[model samples]
Target: MKVTHNTAAGTFTLTGKMWSNTYPLDQLDAWLAFYRRQRDEHPKSGNSYDKGIAGLGRCRHSSRPRPADQLALRAEGQAGACVRVLGRWAEAVSRGKG
Candidate 1:
């Protein structure tokens, strides 16, 4: 995936493929954040936290599942505002009326 962080616009972008096609840039950004956190903690690469990208379980929908859908539970672990920030960034970046 490709990411571009435009501080001036306060936006973050995550780009990649989903279900054989580009899964909207906004979706990509959300997935990317989750992947990064997951990737770093996983025991291995390519297989680390790569199981919950499509809203699947096993990952429990946490915010740092590497590849899980962390749109809701990414906060209970770290500081208490990570999830909000992530969602905000995603939503802010997802703006622009695409």
Candidate 2:
């Protein structure tokens, strides 16, 4: 991904691809959408979006932050079905069943 900062003085550029496995394809797509909207809207003094998104830098969400069933995760937490993996064959490896 590319990041650029422009102000009265000049411009600065930052570049990096995702540095973590937590960034799955679907999650990356959704986050790119959020950033695109932020760029389009240009909200919050032209810097808040950067700060807010940067705060999430190198940090993994417990789950996808957008378009995922937050309620499902919370409810599953209470119901003892709190599985984080989403693949059809993903499961605990304790019994060699992952």
Candidate 3:
């Protein structure tokens, strides 16, 4: 799977049979978190994490953030956390846990 961050567009584009979803920055954390948790709890489960990510991608798109952008700014930290979690999950999966 290939996931690219288009800074110009502020979007994440994931492409592959297993990961074909365009995820907005706003909802990236939730998607990463749900998949990470499932992977952590069931490392050996085949494709659960993949399925979770895909399922999240299929969910209705999140509405744009409200004009009060303070809350969204505060949640910027979550974006980093999500990246870390996704990294670990990917490493584990690559090592054959899944």
Candidate 1, residues 1-98: lDDT per residue as tens digits?
43443222233444455522224333544655667678777756765345444332222222222212443344445443555546555664567421
TM-score of 3: 0.39
Put down candidate 3 lDDT per residue, 1-98, tens digits, no spaces.
44445322346665677657787766666766777788778879877467547544543233222222432443345776445444544555677752
Q: Rank the candidates by lDDT, best first.
A: 3, 1, 2
TM-score of each: 0.26, 0.27, 0.39
**lDDT value for candidate 2?**
0.40
Error of 1 at 58 (Å): 30
Per-residue lDDT of model 2, residues 21-79, tens digit only: 23333344366468657866875556645643653333223222222254344434443
Please give the lDDT score for candidate 1. Answer: 0.43
Give lDDT per model, in order: 0.43, 0.40, 0.53
> Residue 18 in model 3: shift from native, Å?
4.9
Error of 2 at 34 (Å): 3.5
Candidate 1 vs candidate 3: which has greater lDDT? 3
Clashes of 2: 0
24: Cα error in model 3, Å: 1.1
